[model samples]
Target: MGALLILAPFVPWGEFLSASIKNPGKYQRQKVVIDNKPEYKAAAGKVVNVNDLQTFPPNSNWVISYPSSGDSTLDAADADTFTKYELIRLPAELGGDMKDASAFVAFNKVCVHLWCSPNYNPAEGHKQYECPCHGSAYRLPDGLATAGPAAIQPPPTNAMPILILTADNDGALNIEPPVWEVNRNGVLGMGRALYQDGKVNVYKEAG
Candidate 1:
């Protein structure tokens, strides 16, 4: 039995292995649409104005949808997991102002550790993204893991996926379409790595 168990890995599972090897491209990495306009939509298909976000109490956050799937019937509140993001308005001490893109940040709600959803805690001196499932905590603004298991993980998995925001001439905030290759604007479920200069680096799968 021991020998059979040891040799099991060497044996191909017939058609499954053969089909996978025959069509290697069938499992290519997910492709995202990069040409989607940067528009922010709130629950019930309401268009969120960037200026309104600025007026929100400091440290407040709202769930928004980005990179529309072009389905007008789909409610923003019902957006797919990957398209949902938590938009945070920084506090005054964290460089939050009523204007400028720096006042806000958006992070993927999916926790990289175990795919549990994290929530924003606005308690004074405790503003952070906290995972209720495992107590993994991420610091505010940058989404860096500061406590719990996520903190001990290596790069790419140590940080939460963040979105890049830009302001239009009319003061509406838009989300720059995400590029999964380099983790720019961040890949939905995957975490991000940072360079020494604090810029997001290309994602490398963990070994």
Candidate 2:
């Protein structure tokens, strides 16, 4: 039990963002609990019907926050305790041809260019995730920077970090805690540690 003592201070971070909370659009941290676990589960499994995803119409996004209980020092400030996920549904060509070929996809909401929340836009048949700060547009499903200054930026890792999801036998979708930084190969190792510690559980089997 002594080894488990280290897990105490490292509890799941953040509380649920209230509907009345100002700047709901702003980026912040929140606690994400596993489903039916007494605590909140962020927004995972919130979509009662996976098929209802299509009803959102194209170029729209469903934003949800999950507890990134692990340290995100490599991506954000060490004190910054949460990672937000931006959810959207697109065509098969965009979202990595998943198991069910589900068009639903999730991405780190922080824009690689200056970290503004990107919005969904579909005008003149051009669908893209557009960042408001500098007019950066990342191609949908894959979150690749196809247009905008982000494409020309020096960070070299322009694609937004993606969230990989797995569905349960009951059709509930769960987001796999990201363990690596996308496009940079830098590892977000803390995420996996938290899962193993039982401090976090993104899915039942993994918990």
On TM-score, the leading prediction is 1
Cα lDDT tens digits, model 1, 1-207, are: 433321212212243224324555442322111221324223234344556543344677666555555443453436465556777778778866567667877778787666678878888878888888668799867788898777766665678887677667776666654444224444445566665467545332311
What's the alpha carbon RMSD for model 1? Answer: 9.9
Per-model root-mean-square deviation over C-alphas = 9.9, 14.7
Top-lDDT structure, candidate number: 1
After superposition, the stretches of candidate 2 with alpha carbons farther than 4 Å from their true spots are: 1-45, 53-59, 68-82, 91-101, 154-156, 183-207
lDDT of 2 by residue, 118-147 (tens): 766756566778878667787765566777
Against the hidden reference, what TM-scores do the models get?
A: 0.67, 0.53
Deviation in Å, model 1, residue 69 alpha carbon: 4.7
RMSD (Cα, Å) of candidate 2? 14.7
Question: How much lDDT does each candidate structure score?
Answer: 0.59, 0.45
